[model samples]
Target chain A: MGARERIWTAALIVIGDEILSGRTQDRNIAQIASWLNVQGIRLREVRVVADDSDAIGEAVNALRARNDYLFTTGGIGPTHDDITVDAIAMALGVGVEVHPAARAMLAGYYETRGGLTEARLRMARVPAGADLIENRMSGAPGIRLGNIFIMAGVPHITAGMLEALTGTLEGGAPLLSAQIGCWVAESEIADLLSEAERSHDGCQIGSYPFFREGRVGANFVVRSTSQAGLDACMADLKAALEKAGWPTIAGGI
Target chain B: MGARERIWTAALIVIGDEILSGRTQDRNIAQIASWLNVQGIRLREVRVVADDSDAIGEAVNALRARNDYLFTTGGIGPTHDDITVDAIAMALGVGVEVHPAARAMLAGYYETRGGLTEARLRMARVPAGADLIENRMSGAPGIRLGNIFIMAGVPHITAGMLEALTGTLEGGAPLLSAQIGCWVAESEIADLLSEAERSHDGCQIGSYPFFREGRVGANFVVRSTSQAGLDACMADLKAALEKAGWPTIAGGI
Candidate 1:
C-alpha cells in the first residue's frame, strides 16, 4: 500500500429515540470507540437517528456512501418498529426474505421458550443476499450484506458482536497518547502555546478547560503514536507555562 | 415577540482528555439538557474537545457566537488542566485576575481541608468582569459573564449550581413535550406516515430504532407542548399504522 492508502473505518447508526429524549443511557458509542481504538479501526461518525423507516433508510444510504463499513442497531425486533431489515432492504434496493439460517436460529430460541407465534417469526426476516453474523449471547443472528451489519441495539449484544468482528478488520495503528491534567486557564499559555505547537512537528498537543470544584481551568494533553514525539512536545509546553508564572499545581490523571 | 426575538441556548465544552481518550463517561450533556429544557431554554449543540486551551478557546468562541448562553464544565479544579477561566478570559479579550469572591470561596474550602497554598489559590483566578456561580458541593465558585455560565464538570456539583441559579432566574414557558416508545419498524408504514405528518399542526414526532431481547425494532416518540395538538397527532399516526397492518404490540415495556 502507498502512503496515501486509506485505512478501514465504520460509522455507527444508533437507532433509538431514548438517547434523544434523555430516557435511556447510551453505552454503545463509548464501547465501540474503545474496541475500535484497540483494533486500530476507526469508528468515524456516529448518528443517533429516530426509528422512522424513512430516517433509517436515509441514514443507512448516506453512511454506506461515505464509509468502508456500516453498522446499524435497533429496529430489528418482532414488533412494529422492528423495521430495520425492511428499511435496509429498501435502502439497498433489495427484497426482504427470511434467511434460512436466521429463521432457524430464531426458531431454536423461540421453540425452547415454549411459544413461537407469527409475531415471533417476524424476527427472522432478513434482506436478500445477506450473510448471518452469529450472535453468541442469543440465538437470532445479525445480518451482514455489502459491508453493512445490522445488529441488535441492546448494548450487551452490540458489544458482543463488535468484539467478535474486530479481529478481522485492518485499520490504522492505534493512537497512543500520554497527558497530564491540571487546574490552569488556557490564555495563560496562549502565546508560547502556538510556538510549542510549531515546535512539535509530528505530535499534536491539546488544551482543554472544565468547570469543576467551583472554578474554571484547563487540561493540556500532548498526544502522538510515537512516545519520543510526545515527550519532546510536553517538555516545551511545560517550560513555556513555567516561565509564564502559571505553573500547574497538580500532575498526571 | 418578533421573528428576530432569538431564544437563548447553550453548548457545553467537556475539556478533559479522559473523555477523548475514553477514560471517563461524560455526565454533563444530558444533565444540562434536561435542566435547560425545564427552564424553557434550549441546549442546541455540544462538542467534546480535548484538554487543550487553544481548542477550548476555539470551540467556546464558536458556540458563544451562535448561542445567547454557554456553559462549560471540568478544568476548574486546583490542578494544572483547569484552564477554562483562562480560555474564556482570552476569548473575551479580557485578562485573568483573582476575583475576590472566587478567592474567598477557595480560601473557605481550603481552610476546611487544610492549607491554602498557592496551588489552591490558583482556583481563585477567574476572568475579569465575571460574576461568581457558587458551588455548594465544594467551595470553589464558578463564574458568569454576559450569557456564559461556567460551572463544574463533576455531575453532582454541576447539577447543584445549575439548580441554584435557575431557581433565581425567571424563565419563559417554552413548549413542553411527552414521548411514546414502542416496538415497530419504519419501512412497514412509510406512505401513510407522511399523510399523518401533514395532519399535525404544532407537534413533531420522532422515531428511533433499537434491538432488544434478541429482536430489532423502532421506538416511536411523538412530542408536543399542546395537549390537544399531541392528542390529534397521535390519533392519526396510530390509525395510519394500524391500517398499514403494523399495530403496536401489547405487553411491551
Candidate 2:
C-alpha cells in the first residue's frame, strides 16, 4: 500500500471469563483503541471471549488473519485459568515452554519475598519462539509472537506494556478529532452534519445525543487522518449549526 | 442437545466509530452480558466494529448464524451516522421502511416538543417484518428481527430495552457464582485452586489477582449452572485456602 493510501489496522481479543460473566467491566478495549490511534494504527475490531482455549485460539487465528496486528488481554497470570499463552501456542501449532529470560526475571522478582514456586514459574511460560514485551509494573513480561502482542488483563500493567511499545510499531498517519456540542436535538441538524461530511473528503462525523438538565442535546465528533480535512469538516459543521439557529460549544456538553 | 445440558449462547455487535475511535467507552458489553446471564443465556462472544454498513452486516450475519441470538448496540439514533437499522436490513435481505406504529409513536412524542421533521422521523425506520421493542424512557423503540435485537448505544436506554425483554426469550438454568478472596499471591495457591476445580464436577473457578495496600491478593470466582454445585465448590475452595494458611474473605476484596 502507498504511504498516503495505507491505513494500518489492529484487532483485539479480550480473553477473560470475568468480562464475559459480567463480573468485571472491561477497561482495556478503550485504552487499547486510543493507544493504537495515537500510534497511527486504527483499532478495527475487538472480540471478547471466555477463558476457553478453543474460543481464544479461534479469535486469535481469525483476527490475526484480517488485521495488520492482533492483541490479546487477560489470561496471562499465574493461575490455571491464565491460559492465553497456552491457547495462542495451540493456535500457532507449537508447544509452550518456559522462556529462560522470563524464568530468570520471575526468579529474581520473587527471590526477595519467596522462592519461585511451580505456580509462580507458570508466568514464565510462553509460546515457542516468542519474544518478551517488558512489563515495568510487574515482573512477569508480556509476550510478542509475530504480529500478536499478549498483554496483561490488569489495566495498569497493560498500560505499562503499551508505554514500553511506543514508537516501535509501523503505523500510518495519526487520526485527528474535533468535537462540537449543541443544545438542539440532533434530529434538527442531522442534514447539516451529513452535508458537511459529504463536502469534506476523508472525514467522518459521529453524533452522540444526551438528555441532561431537563433538555436534550448532542455532541458531534469529526475525525480525519488529515489535519486539514478534519479542520475543514469541523469549521463547516460549526458554521452550518450556527446558521440553523443552534448555538455550538467547542468542547462537548 | 440435551434439555439440561444445552447452553444457549448469544453474540453482540457494537457498531460505531466513536467506540472504535476511543471517544466513547462502552458500557453495553458488560450490561448485556450480565443481562444475558440472568436470563440463563451465555454471551459467547462480542465484536466491536465501525459504523460502516459492510462491517455491521457481515458481523450480524456471521454471529447470528453461529449463536442462538444476536444483539447490536449503537448507530440507531436519528442522525445520519445511525445506520445500524439500514445495515441490518440489508443483512437480512430486506428493504428498509418506516413502521407505521413507530412513526405514530414518534409523531406523538414530537408533537408536543416540536413536529417530527424528516430527520426525527428517521428513527421510525426498520427492516421489513421487524417488530418494535418497547422503549418506555424514549419514544423511539428498539428493533427486533428474527434473533437479532438492535438496541440504543446509550447505556440507560439500552438498560430500559433489556428490562422490557426480561424473561421473554427462552433460556436454560441461570448460572450461579460465589466468590472467595484471600490476601495471598495467587501463584502460591494456584495448584490448590486448579485441583479444586478439577475435583468439582461442574464448577469452573476463575482467579483474579490484585495488589493493594502493598500486598498481593486474589479473588476466586466459582460458577456452575447448579446452585448446589456452586456452593459446594466455593466451600471446598475456601476450606482448601484456609488449610493452606491463607485466610479467605467470604466476598471479594
Candidate 3:
C-alpha cells in the first residue's frame, strides 16, 4: 500500500490439527511461498494453527489485519475437526450457511456417492457476505471474506485455489539482486556499505558471510528498485573497497 | 514437562526485516519442521516478526511462555538493522553488554585487517543471564537466555547451532510413521475418518490428499504409542473401509 507499489501480499495460516500434533511436515508454506514469490506478490508470514476454533479465528483476524491478503490452508474439510469455515465466519462477524454456488459445487462431487446427507452438506457452508473461491480439483470450494481467502488443507485443493486467485493479485515491482563474494567480513567494507545503502535509498543491502578456498569472506548483495541505482551502488561500493586496501579483482595489486 | 517419555521440544521464531517486508521466501520453517519431526520433538508454533524492538520482544515473551525450548534464527549480525539482541534482552528484562564468551569467540577473527571495531563488537553483546551457543564457522556465537537459543539467520550457522544443541536435547521416544494411499477425496472420507479418529485415541491420524498413479487419493497415516497398537488400528481401518464398500486395499497392497 506504499507508493506505486500495491504491495500485494498474502500470509499463510495453516489450520490443520495434523501439523501441531507433529503428524505432518507441512509442504504448503514453502511451495506457496516459492510460487507467489515468483509472481511478485510476497507471501509474508505463515502461522500453523490447530483445529481449535479460538486459535483459528485469532490467527485469521491477526494476519488479515497485517497483510494485503491472507490465505488460510487447511481445516476446511468435511470431517468434524475441520472447523475453519466456522472460525473464518466468526472472525469476520458473519453468519455462515450453505450458499447456492457452494452447495452446487458440493452436490456435483457428492451426487455419485449415495450418502449426500446434512453432514456432507456442511462443507457447503460459507460466510453470509463472501465470494466463492473456485475449486478445480475437488468440489468443496473455498470462500473469500475481505482479505482472507480460506482454502482446503489438502495439497491439491490448496494448489488449485492458488491458481484460481492468481489473476486477482497485484504486487510491487520485483527487486533485482546481484551477489559478489570477497575475502572480507561485513566490517571490512563498512563505509562502502553505508554509501551503498545511503546512495540507493530504494535498495536493500545484505552481507552474507562465507568461507571458501581456505578463506573467510562475505558476499555483499545489493538489491534495488532500479537497475541504474544498483549499478551506482555497486560502483561506489567497489571504489570504497579498493580505497580501503582490499584489492579489487580487476585493479591489479 | 510432559509424560515419562523423554520430551523433544523446539520453538522457532523467524527474525528478519526482509520477512516483514515480504522480500524473501522463508525456507527455515519447513526445513526445521522436517528436521524436528524426524527427531520426535515437536517444532511448535512459529512467530515471524520484523526487526522492530517491540514486535520481537512481544513475540519472544509469548513464545517463551508456551514452549519448553526456543530457537531463533536471524538478527544475530553486525549491522544497524540487526536489533535482535537488544530486543531479546528487552523481552527477558535483561541488559546486554560485551559478553566475555562472545568476545573470546571473536578474538583473532580479524587482526591486521582494519575491520572488527567497536561497532562490530556489537555482535559480541549478549543478554546478561545467557550462555554462548557455538558458531563453528563464523565467530558470532548465538546467545542462550534460559530455554531460548538464539541463532544466526544464515542457514549454515542455524544448522550448526541446531546440531550442537541436539546432544543436549531431551527427546520423546522417536516417532515412527507408516503411510498408505487410498483413492478418495478428503471430502469423500469424512464420516469414516471420524470413526477412524475416534477408534485411535492413542495415535495421531493424518490424511493427506494427493494425486497418485493418476488417481486422486488420500494417504492415510496412523501413528500410535506402540507398533502393536499401530498394527491393530491399521487392521481395523482396512476392515472398516471394506465393510463400508470403499476402495479397500490389503495391508501390503
Candidate 4:
C-alpha cells in the first residue's frame, strides 16, 4: 500500500469479570472503536478476557505485537481484582512500581476528599518506565507503556482518556462510510452488491438485513479510506438497486 | 478438578466489519454469555474479528482449541461478505458443501416468497459434515460441526438457536451470585473485601463502583458454584461493611 493508503490498526482487550459473567454489558468496545476512527486508526480486533493475570498477559502480548497500538479497558481500579498493571508488566518482562507523577496527581485529587489511602494509592502503580495518560474523570490516570495503553474499565473514564490522547497518536486517512437502505431482502440484491464492490477499488459493501413491519429489509454500508472511492461505490450501488426496481433510502432505515 | 466440580467453558468469535468499523454495536457477546451461564457453561473468552477470511479462520482455530465449546456469530448470510462457512471449513481442514437439509429448508421457505436464486442458495453451504441448527425466524439455519457452532449475528436469531440447543449440551453446576450495594467508596473497604474473598473458599467477589446522585457507591457481586458458599461470603462481607459504619443494601442499589 502507498503512504496515503496505509492502514493503521489497533486492538482492544476488555478486562473485566462483569462483562464475561454477563453482569455488565460492555460499552468500551464501541466507544473505543469510534474514538479510534476519528483518529484515523482502525480497530482491527477485540478480545474480552477475565480479570485473571495469565489471560490478561497472553492477550496483551499477542495483540500488541501485531497491531500498531494496543488498548485495554478495565482492571485498573483500586480493588484487589485490578491486576492489569502487574500482569502487563510481567508480559513485558518489567517490574511494577508506583510512578511518582501519578502518586502526586492522586495525592492532589484526594487531598480534600480523603488522604490517599493504601488502596487508593494502588492506582498509581504502573509498569516500569510507563507514562501516565491523563484521566480527567478520576484521580487515577491511565497508563501508557510503549505502544500499549491501560485504560479505565468504566466507559466514561475511558472516554476522558481518549479525549486526552486525541490528536497525539500518528494515524493514516480516516475510513469513510455511507449507508443505503432498501425495503428488499438482501438476498435479492446480493449479486448487484457484490458486483458493485468488485468494480470499486478500495471499497467494501456490507449488507445488514433486518425484519421490521412484518417485512424484510436491508441496509447496505459502503466503507473506504478514500472519499471519492466511497462516493463512487455508493453511487454505483444505489444505481444498481434502482435498476433492480428497488428504491434506496439514504442514511439507512 | 473432580468430575462434580468440573467447569465447561465456551469461547465466542464475533465476525463483522461493521462492528470493527464502529458502525454497529455488538449485542451477541452479552446475549450469548448470559445464555451460556444458564446452561451451566462459562463464557471464558470472546474475540471480535473482521469479515476477512484469514482473520476469521485464525480466531476460529485458536479459540476452538482451548475451549470446550466454540461459538461464532455473524458472516453467515447470503451476501458475499458471509464467508464464515468457508473460513471455518479451511480452519478445520474440511471442504465446503451444500448440506441437503439446509438446501431443502431454504428451497421450501423461499418457494412462497421467491424462487431460491444462487444468492439465497449460498446460505445452504456449510462445512462438510456439519449439522443444521434450526432457525425459526429465517430460512437460513445455523451450522454445528463437532464442538463449534456457527450462529447468526442478529441477536434474536441467535437467541432462537440458543433456545433450540438448550439442555442438549453437557454442563457442570450452574454458577450462583448475590449482590450487596453500599454508598461508600470501594477503596475505603478494599482491604476488607479482599480479606472476605480470601476467607471464603470457591467464592469470588467483584466490586463495581459508580457515581450517582453526586455520591460514590459500589455494588459487590459474589459468585460461587455452591449456594451456601455464596451466602456465607455475602453475609460476611455485609457484616464487615456494617461494622465499618457503612450500611449495605441487598440485591444491589
lDDT of 1 by residue, B71-181 (tens): 788777655556788888888899999888778777776675555676667778888888888778767787888878888877888988897788554444544565444
Taking the tens digit of each residue's C-alpha lDDT, what string does model 2 give over B1-253? 6899889999999888888888999999999999999999999899999999999999999899999999999988988899999999998899999999999999999999788999988999999999999998888999999999999999999999999999999999988888989999888899999999999998999999998998889999999999989988888998999999999989889
TM-score leader: 4
lDDT of 3 by residue, B38-91 (tens): 666777677777666887887888778777777788888876567889999988
Which numbered prediction scores highest in lDDT against the true structure?
4
lDDT of 4 at A204: 92
**Interface C-alpha RMSD, model 1:** 6.7
Error of 3 at A232 (Å): 4.0
What is the DockQ score of candidate 2, to 2 decimals? 0.84
Give candidate 2 regions above 4 Å deviation: none
Every candidate's lDDT: 0.69, 0.92, 0.72, 0.94
| Candidate 1 DockQ vs. native | 0.10
Write out the backbone clash pairs for model 4.
Answer: A74-A153
Better by DockQ, candidate 4 or 3: 4
CAPRI category for model 3: acceptable
Q: Count the backbone clashes (under 3 Å) in each candidate.
A: 60, 0, 3, 1
lDDT (tens digit, per residue) of candidate 1 on A1-253: 8543355677778676455445556677677767766766556555566566786887789778877888787766665445789888998899988788777787787675645566667777888898888788765678889889898877887777876786776676675665666555454444566678788876666565556677556666676655687788888787777777766543543
lDDT score, candidate 4, position A136: 91
